[model samples]
Target chain A: MSATTNHPMVRFEGVTKRYGALTVLDDLNLEVGRGEKVAIIGPSGSGKTTVLRMLMTLERIDGGVIWVDGEPMTHMQKNGQMVPAEPKHLRRVRSKIGMVFQHFNLFPHMTALANCTEAPMTVLGLPRREAEERAAELLNMVGLGDKKGHYPAQLSGGQQQRVAIARALAMRPKIMLFDEVTSALDPELCGEVLQVIRKLGSEHDLTMLMVTHQMGFAKEFADRVCFFYQGKICEQGEPKELFTAPKNERTQQFLRAVLEAV
Target chain B: MGMFSLSAMLVAALIAIAIMSLFGDNALFMSGLLQGAWLTVQITLLGSLLAVIMATTAALFRLYGAPPLRWLAVTYVEFFRGTSALVQLFWLFFVLPLFGISMDPFSVGVLGLGLNIGAYGAEVVRGAVQGVHRGQWEATTALNMTRWQALKRIILPQAFVAMIPPWGNLFIELLKSTALVSLITMSDLTFRAKTINDTTMQTIPIFTLALLTYLVMSLTITIGMRWLERASLRGMVRGRGR
Candidate 1:
């Protein structure tokens, strides 16, 4: 595997994403080392969430390439020429990454266990018994073992978010992305969801990218923090330094506004 | 309330039978009409099956297929929805024979009704599928599901529940439209009614019986579909309890 430990788990090189005349992401260059925990924080519309979205392949990049595990993800090198990755290539690359959304987007028709097991059985070609076993373990890890038979609609917002985490973990992804995962939950329920993520951060050797508004959780859990402004990473440092002694004027103002609101 | 309605309907039906008995040979009328009704039932059951197949295929094409396939689906839905069902039926029954592609009257009736309603039903299916939340699509993609697998497992099942009421409506419309097939000599209920009226000149009683038969069939379909909707919704209701 070419000494996988030496390679960055994810690298974004001069990535750009635009919508019409508005540039959502502008020549972004970022890298996360293996097993690193990175948190993205910024004002809304500053492209904090876009960073995770582009990595998940949910949004297309207008320019530049993203590399995962030292392999080009957004483009494939074909015959010495870089071309947009084919669907097959995209699927293969994306399988290494898992994402949990703000809405907890669990399949309503499926029970929590089924939702957790679906990707393992369908995409990875794991047998049903093995997939179920893996899903159960992940569910238990997320503290949702008792809710496995419950459908998304039956679970509370916190429970559903936990199931979503387990579902993503069941895929055995090398990298995990969280896009405002606790944003939709009530303030009282947000802690339960954050706890699961905190546990993952401490226990797993997985690269994690999170876009979050929970300043306290980000400070406590993230190894490094990036503050984006106007589609660029305006400031980044250790979470303690970034949160407490932010140097950039924009990051200072953004943090002040957020802290005042809370 | 249910018992009252049932008894009221029974009394009204008995009184209507008493009046009809005074006019014509009820036995002969029923025998001829029953045969026609049987044929109508056959057409409806088969045509509805065909319509569901066509509608789902066209809807999937319109939503996810390549540009050319989407164009074809849109063309079909627009053309059929724009025109009258009668013209489409006549075109199938009378026009296609000239091309040496002849179909029996029964096949024409089923195809004519099925295709016409299928076009309308396609819109219902498309709307339901589109109404599914965007988050569901994102979740499937995040799970690394292929487009086909996503539709088959995640998107379509949720959409299918939304489609039931509308499909029920379309099926009833298809059932009623089957009466039009009588024009091409398929001898459905309407056709048999006309045959009875032609000889006996009992227009009021014959047409009335035909109308009542249609009402009964429509009622059955409505009730059956409502049961299906409730069954499908049971899991959702249970889930909401949390």
Candidate 2:
């Protein structure tokens, strides 16, 4: 919580991730300051999602290390040398981050209220009454207060996604990663989920990293937009500058393709 | 509508008349058969409880235990599934006594039937658990839940619904398999029926009565399991309306 301005909230230092010979992220280095809203945009296979996933600790790093809050995330110092982190170390670091997925992976067996409260009660050791109170507040914030008792199957894709966001926020994570959260929703429904995220972006001091296909939202909401291509950030800048005037040819081509599709 | 189905009422009346007529000639014999049938029920109930426990343990070992424990589970499942149930019963009843492990006939019957059916039930458990969507696991991990907590709270409850129907089949199979316990001198339904057959020399009537008794027990299991399945899935939206 006492993050100094000099130290970025999240830093990827020469981070490399690979699946056999296919490198998903190649010696990538990036940094996000506290409360910065960064959007990642790219064509499929560009490794935009991989960057968010690695930061969430959902994927293993092939080489190099990631730093969160100035501490190494993918490794721990052993005998003055960096070594791959143990599961205990990973869990301790991972508690600081929360992620929302494209599919809105809400537990279908649980009600929306239960889904939001589960992590707080079980993972954070909060008393049930306190967890329920916090979960109710989060559900209300996400505009699903009335639907708290409903199961995921009873909710629309947008509602489910919104509940997923609430569920993540209930943990009070320092960093929130959104991986194309609205991609699976219908065009009309995307607005509601995006609006909730927008409200959070403006109202909270939480650092946000998003991988999204919604270029318009990215332009409006992102402090900085990073354009990824072939597992590297080809270009990045303030949203207005990056979208309107691109210095990289790949970025220009990708934006044209995406805009034409829309 | 009446309290009972018309067909069920008709069946019940016919059974009462038949029993009354049959009772006049075979009163003592009918009473003896009823005692045997009660013993059969007792064995079935105890065996099923044991089978469920063994199957869950074996399935968990197969799914999440260390490599050596997994191998042990696989070996146990394959051995019991591959061998004949009758042979298994005979081995437990006849062979174990030779090794200074003398179990009573009733204990042998329960152990053999339970272990045999549990092996098949173990496969059912494994399939249901694995059938749970991969997204559920990812969701649990994202919530920072440990593997044990996830399995207990999310995965297993979902798997329970999928497991019920197949487990019903295994339960009935176990019930039918209990008849084999008669060979080891257990005074269950089949044993009593055989003893009566020896005395009365009325093969058709005695065996027919035994067959009907087994049918009634099997039907009860089917109906009871259906109720259990519905109760377990009561809150979930997918199967609720149906």
Candidate 3:
């Protein structure tokens, strides 16, 4: 199969975000090429999660624009003017992007199958039977085919996160964002979820942006590794060069602390 | 003057007897008490049903409707909670004619009782709906649910479990409030006792029956509410999954 194309699937142009007085993302300019797997690593407060959250539309940007598949994500351009994304515009753009949250915020009342099928039936207007069939296939891919009838509480944290990944993927989204998908799982359970994600990165041609602390997975699965510090990309390169020989001092310091802790 | 304190002293002793036995006497006095108690239960059951419906609709309007409808909900709740039940009962039974609307004494009694308890019930309902977790909202939004869909399928089902306790308390209070409906000529428990007192010339025995009847009504409501709570919470436990 062919690799990523030169065209960008996701791009942020001078994007900035703030919460009250604190600036969480400061004028970030980044792009993920079509069908590429990019891993973002950073210290605790380095805003890696914010980048993924922005792509998910869970948080809004304070300034600048984000483009997805050559269309602006946060707004629509009309007559050379940028306007707030109308409901229709947002729905169209959002349908192409899918997100798996850090906490696996599954609907506690729904079984795993229902969780995966809800959006397809509701937003995509798919029939219930069709949605369920698609959901079953996605569940099998995530190694959760038999757990489809179980509620979120009946599953372990790792199982719930894996189900969340299937739920995000069921939409057949062109781009996927994973924000700390394994951070909430136990150390022993993290590997299974990480393995599923690594399998997705290789098997699917979809573009993915992942924020994680798993250095080994980042080095193994990512086409590019970005080390972020203080809301800025401090260093970015091939995973081997960035992890073993990062050019920036801040990147090295952050890596040293993360490595020592594990 | 000597007769007044004498009767008061005698009634005080009867009050002590009433408290000690909890009015469980099986004598003729208890027979009169039970007849009155039955009427009280009838009024409370019907009145509380009306109250719960009104309270739930008002709470929904306050939480989901436009600003004007929300204001109307607020105004309705405040008007009932602000006025005494006696005054409201009087207004419903007597003053409704100014607008050319008239109803029977029983209808007025139910309306007065319902309107009064409904005010308190609305606050309870509002609090229950707000008690749903914030993360639930996020999950619903991520699924692209409309606001009404989120409220119906996700929020309100969770809120129903929380609303029952406060609603049960209001039901007990409603049992007592039905006594005010007697002044409007409904012949509820308090009215029955007053009629017996006039004909039998035995004020102590009649009023004592009324007190026992009120106790029975309140106890029945309390027990029934506990049963309903258990039934409703069973469903909630299944959703929460232990």
Candidate 4:
């Protein structure tokens, strides 16, 4: 529908994900523009996390193709027909995307610096010296420079999450996915993590898709907000418009419940 | 080795010394048992090494191999673990000789016990690898690591710490089973004790010495395993205390 250069950084074309008979993401179609920050807000079981997970290829798509950086991530072209992707195709397409989990899943056995350097050295095939230098810079960027030699267990929840962000950023991925990253942190700790994310959104040109329950942060940080309800986008628009005046019944009810809880 | 518990080593040393002192009146008998004990130690070490290799290979095969390879691994694990070690040892030492594949008694002992204990160790490896959190695998995937890279660089290292205690138990079980090798006429500690008993009818001192030596050997395994668990855990957890 537009110039190839104007294509979104990510597109979910009729994507479906299911667990047995339960459809989690039902024939979903969503597009995220390059360098845009899109926040997915929904109630529990709305498939918000699954959307991000499918893009990361952590979950299998039951039906449709997921495109990343203008390439099919879950399939490859063979004989002019689409087929399930080979490992080489999957890996090459996947390198453009990185994810941060809610649990701050740092490699426990490695120090912060090593955690960040591991992928750069092994997957990206960067030299150890350069990897360390890049990791050090990213760790410092996340404000954990002094804790580079410390293991993940030694860091606070906020500190570990910042390191996780740095580890992801070290890969230089164009699209970053965050799956309820602040859900596991303390209320005070949430700010530090959100701040780091906000810094990334503002300072870097990367496109980001975050599944967040933090409505305020979502409103402030996101260019567009998609309110998901029962595996579909119920309402979506500029953050201010969607937050201030929502038209969908489910979105209205969900926001009201969240506000009441707070 | 540096991280090994000193008190455990000291206790083992004291037990050996006390057992030796009790044999003061029978120095020749003591030397014979000691020599046999040394052979048992060697057999245990080599057998344990082989068992480790078999366990890791079989577990990986069972977990990640294709259909045929998976079936082969499962068969090996069940066959070794299901049958009696004594029968397996006899089959290897006796049955194979009749088939014109005679091996040295030492080789039979090592092979039989290695294959036997490794079966039990396969489950240990699998359980430990599976015990690692699912999040670790997702993190590795997000980093663009291949399955092999994930297993080698992340999964196995974490699993190694979890597996050591169970491997320690298997090793001790393997050490105890070395006595079964004497049935194949391998001249381990048990064989020497039996021979000495037949001649001197000294079941009291000779059998007692054999039991003490086995205890010492198993204690060494336990201590060594504990040391390994700690050394692996140090880099993961020691950032807090020191």
Candidate 5:
């Protein structure tokens, strides 16, 4: 494990999420070992994306606690007890994670290089020269070194997704979340983004949690595969075991449906 | 936008200026109107500065402030937006003295109209801020940005681009509403027209000049805003690289 501490890179202890009357993630307990690539797959409304969203702190969980690098994300230990984290505490813990979205949410007003450098300079307080150097390096890694001056509007969907990935990686997050990063791309474009993901997986010792519909990639790349159903993990195990001989009927049905859709 | 061609408006302003100069034989009449127009310009400048500040603050408060501060912002926007600008001007000028908040006529004009126009501008600002994609905000969170940092570095610059056109309309509205100050006893352009018309009964020339002056001023605002919009977008999107 690449973990700096004895604890797992991420642990979800009895985490529950709800939206008004809907319970999206129910009493979910999961853990990710450092440097493990976990892929979450399920049908729409099965709460697959919510897992990544909750981890990223985009949507606040209604119940339970999430730990990153052995520390609670939404709550902080106060003397002997836990309380909801203050902004300062939350920001500190949350900085360990980063996310890329399906929509490729690049800041439309900034150049590709600016989008990558802004948070590092402003939030991390890196000087312009260092930030720019780091950003330029990441942009090149994502294969957009020549396009750093291009705005989001000027790039293709695939190029934008790569930039978004670079922007997320620019934060030097220990845990990266991919929330359907290629769902919006053209089929030809999906390959370029997937190639970046593949390269990042091989190159970095970072824990990755990807919510995806790409069964092939999940089966091939993920260290473990989790199939979520009705906000519960119906089946999870080694990707080969789960793909070859899933025990849960719901998992089998979901996999069959997904295969048919292709 | 189709009905509101900018070049056509500029041409109309030129025609109005031509008409004003054609009757420049009435030099005293022209000069009196000119002085009034100058006061209008000053009031518009100061009031607009205040309005922009108030609008941005109230919009931020309404969206992200604490409970009490949010309520204060809500009440402010509703009160000023829901009521008449003229009544607001009157209350600040005529009624505030009863409440131990007396001000000179000029201050009242600037404060009252600044606040009233700011109320409308708050909505514009809010719409533009919220109009930014939800994912942009999520991206900020993913990067672990402080709320203030997200707004200042990421959000507001984007929102500013969207807001310029509506803000231009509000500015022109503010310029037109400067006429209301004249009713409260400030010697603005409209007041000068009414006064010189009453004194000399040169109704045709005086009222026409006043109407033309307002048109020219509003046209100037429109032109300035167009320039600002172009300048801002230059570095923002594709084909307009810095």
Candidate 6:
């Protein structure tokens, strides 16, 4: 639908990943337009998170390339041949991207404000005063301004995850990757993180690629949804259309299982 | 109680008092022993400093360097740990001259004590580093931090706290091991005791003072380590944060 959204913000061209004999992702291809929220849904071990991990460079592609803002990321052109991107160049390209992991991955030793400020001050080279001011703003945006001085162990899982979202945002990334950000939270705490994410998606005009199991949130929040199975996208389409009337039998089965589990 | 049991208890208690008085007395022999023990304390302090620097280097090389460097780290750790420190100290003092490398007595003593403890300290440093949660690596990498930056700013600070307990244990061991350096004619505490015994013809008194000084040094280090541990670990538990 929509003819693949010309000049996509994030594009994967025949990406593949393998863990020795396992083949975690097999010749996968996808595209997300600028400022679009796309959710990936699948059973455990279905390569759903692998897609996000690859974009974040936590996992490298076994074959093919990824383009962010229309520039190649997985490989660099060297001697007129595509080679694996060098670490230095890869870091520069990756700085434009941000990721929030399932476990919240907050720096345990730092307070929430310090966590938000660290990347800005260290990686972005912002002055301490400026970074602290921006971190305060981010904390307020995530509705955790009061918890800024608290370490991760002092915060609830949901609160820590929201801070992690704020930390990712502090980098001012063009593309944000969420790898099951809510799956680690308790049912009662999940709403707060999801709410912050939904607000960011609407207010910031951010490009987002998320892996989540909250079918209702995915249906309401994402512009498009992709259903993955056995290391490949089984089906992908507009959220409203895909959830209500899936084109693939696998997607229908997955939706039924997820809904029943919920 | 019977006289035999009562007397036996009295004898044990007197021995303890005698040991205590050896450290506290103002006798000529006590002062002589203390001067010798001072040498041991100084040697141990210098040796521990060398251990800290060398162990940190060995651990970093093993973690970040090329295969040859890593192999060298592993070899260094195993070599010193595998053999007795006495042999290494003796070999350094005696054999290296064949290859035209001769260090002074004090340097040899410090080097020997340092390298012996460095082997064990390297393992402690390595474990503490790798023990950090893998999530830290991902978070730092996501921020696009250079490897060294991540280690210095994010990883090593936490690792340093984790390392203190093992380092304390190493300090105590290093203190005890410094006595070995006296064999190289370093005039360390043990060597000083021998020198005094030769001059004053008082073996038991000099040795008793040497033992008490060592005990004091070890106890001081133990208390210091406990204090360091508490200070470093302070904010880890909630409700205690200042």
TM-score of 6: 0.91
Worst 10 residues of 2 chain B by lDDT: B1-10
lDDT of each: 0.89, 0.88, 0.81, 0.89, 0.90, 0.85
Q: Using DockQ, rank the candidates from best to worst.
A: 5, 4, 1, 2, 6, 3
All candidates: DockQ:
0.51, 0.40, 0.22, 0.52, 0.53, 0.34
Q: Write the per-residue lDDT of candidate 3 for residues B135-242, one digit (tens) a residue.
A: 566666555566677787777777877777688679989988888877877667787777766776667766755775565555555555566767665423433321
TM-scores computed on chain B for all candidates:
0.90, 0.91, 0.80, 0.90, 0.93, 0.84
lDDT of 3 by residue, A1-262 (tens): 1454455899999999999999999999999998889999998888998898777777889999999888797989899999978867776788888888778877666789988998788767899999999999999998999999988878888898998889888888888888888887889999889989888888989898999988999999999998888999988999999988888999888889888988
Question: For model 1, how does the per-residue alpha-carbon lDDT over B1-242 read when each residue is reduced to its tens digit?
Answer: 24356456645665675566566477569778879999999999999998999899999999989999999999999998999999998998889999998999999999989999999999999998888888888888899999898998888888888899899899999999999999988999999999889998877778887777777677667767877988888766522312
Provide the clashing-pair count of each candidate structure.
Answer: 1, 0, 0, 0, 0, 0
lDDT of 2 at B211: 78
Give candidate 6 regions above 4 Å deviation.
A1-6, B1-26, B194-208, B237-242
How do the residues B87-125 of candidate 4 rate in per-residue lDDT, one tens digit apiece?
999998879989899999999999999999999999999
Assign candidate 5 its CAPRI class.
medium
lDDT per residue as tens, model 5, B125-176: 9999998878889999999999899999888988899999999999999999
Best-first order by lDDT = 5, 4, 1, 2, 6, 3
Per-residue error (Å), model 6, residue A190: 1.0
TM-score of each: 0.95, 0.93, 0.81, 0.96, 0.95, 0.91
Residue range B7-63, candidate 6, lDDT tens digits:
455455446536655553326666666676777888789999999998999999999
Question: Which of the predicted structures, 1 or 6, would earn the higher TM-score when compared with the native?
Answer: 1
TM-score, chain A only, candidate 6, equals 0.96
For candidate 6, the per-residue lDDT at A70 reads 73
Q: Relative to the unseen true structure, what is the C-alpha lDDT of residue A181 in candidate 5, on a scale of 0 to 100?
A: 87
Candidate 1, residue A175: CA error in Å?
0.7
